[model samples]
Target: MKTFDHLSVIGLREWIGLPELGIDRVRAKVDSGAKTSALHASDIVTFYRDGETWVRFKAHTGTRRHPRDVECEARLVSFRRVRSSNGQLQERHVIRTDLVLGDQRWPVDFTLTCRESMRYRVLLGCSAMLDGQLVINPGQRFVQGFPQTDRTLRG
Candidate 1:
């Protein structure tokens, strides 16, 4: 009998894309230690737009000084309490969305948080890296395409 394998195993840093949100070539940290994927978001405000539930938040991609507030309409999935590396437990907003890694795309749940100090704005966790797909090379950076230069123009 053969044991089924899942996920090609990725390194700490890798390039990822959120095609559903029109984001391409965004740097993401693959942290198996984390249970849920996290995205750097600030000033998170949830409101109704066009009679639909939507969320508006600011995100700092490449730099912490420069933050871009992006508005995305996502269905509220669940609320979870997560503990940070510093041992701080906080309630976070989780939403289900699509993520593109290498040549594969799948649905993933991302938590909203203000990760201003982190190097990468996007952090992909274990649940998001399932199915024996992504293989992250630690020594390698930007395995696929180049990162986007303009965050304001992400549409």
Candidate 2:
């Protein structure tokens, strides 16, 4: 048997954090099949920030029965035409943000779109794991545990 100790093992689902956007906790579906990550967003609007494009939207981070909204604003990376899992082509707003999963934190690009019908609000795609830093265990869940956050001051 061979092992890659340099890679972090993550399950099909994990808890993650987007500190720059003030997101303390959110469930994400780790999908290597997905080329790009996505976030469930609504009321998406674009504006100019110092002559650069910026986006503002409301992200749904909770279940449909218990909805939680988080207002987020980020510099627009670009508008990408993506084919959804259902085979629908649509233009989506892309934004770069730091993703915190367990002890590892790194920048990731996420496409903002409506995923109301999906089970998970966030999707961690293959591009975010392209650096060969992670190995996904399909049969497991939450292998990295909950993402560490500084929400509570350590004393």
Candidate 3:
């Protein structure tokens, strides 16, 4: 995508995957209104490594009966105090990683949180869209096409 030249049109919802983070088929809701992206992560643990903070979390993707477990570890980028759609405030762990959508892979910074209550497992917000690099077609779904399962599993 050309920065400031053209915007990549995407649909309302897309199946995005983070292969490096050991997550595949993360059903994400694309929201241009939201400022930052968030992922549904459980059993979050934080630790220090050589004076830098690192995180370890488990991602359970897919349905309850067909669930898949993926263990992920990433360097902690920041801690963000975010307000939810329902006007609830919480501090969340922020991490930077690459996300694959369609045929493109790009770095995205996202907050780690428990989004189990939400319909989608992930939320792709405006900030991660790179300030107008993406245009959302609210009426459509999977404009970039479905996810290709080419990733090898990691623990």
| Best-matching candidate per TM-score | 2
lDDT of 1 by residue, 32-142 (tens): 778899988777778776776666666555655655545455766777999977799999888777776655567899898978778788988877866426655677655
Top-scoring candidate (lDDT): 2
Q: Estimate each model's TM-score.
A: 0.76, 0.95, 0.86
lDDT of 3 by residue, 1-155 (tens): 64533777789999888877877667789988889999888889999999999999987666555666688899999999999888899999999988888767788988998776777778999987874378777889988875554662232
For residues 1-155, could you state the per-residue lDDT of candidate 2 as single tens digits? 99988999999999998988889889999889888999999999999989999999999999988999999999999999999989999999999999988878899999999999999999999998875399988899998877776772241
Which ranges in model 3 have alpha carbons more than 4 Å from their true place? 1-5, 148-155
* Whole-model alpha-carbon lDDT for candidate 1: 0.70
Comparison by lDDT, 1 against 2, better one: 2
For each candidate, how many residue pairs have backbone atoms clashing (under 3 Å)? 4, 0, 0
Question: Would you list the rank order by lDDT, best first?
Answer: 2, 3, 1
Task: Write the number of the candidate with greater TM-score, choosing between 1 and 2.
Answer: 2
Candidate 1 residue-pair clash tally: 4
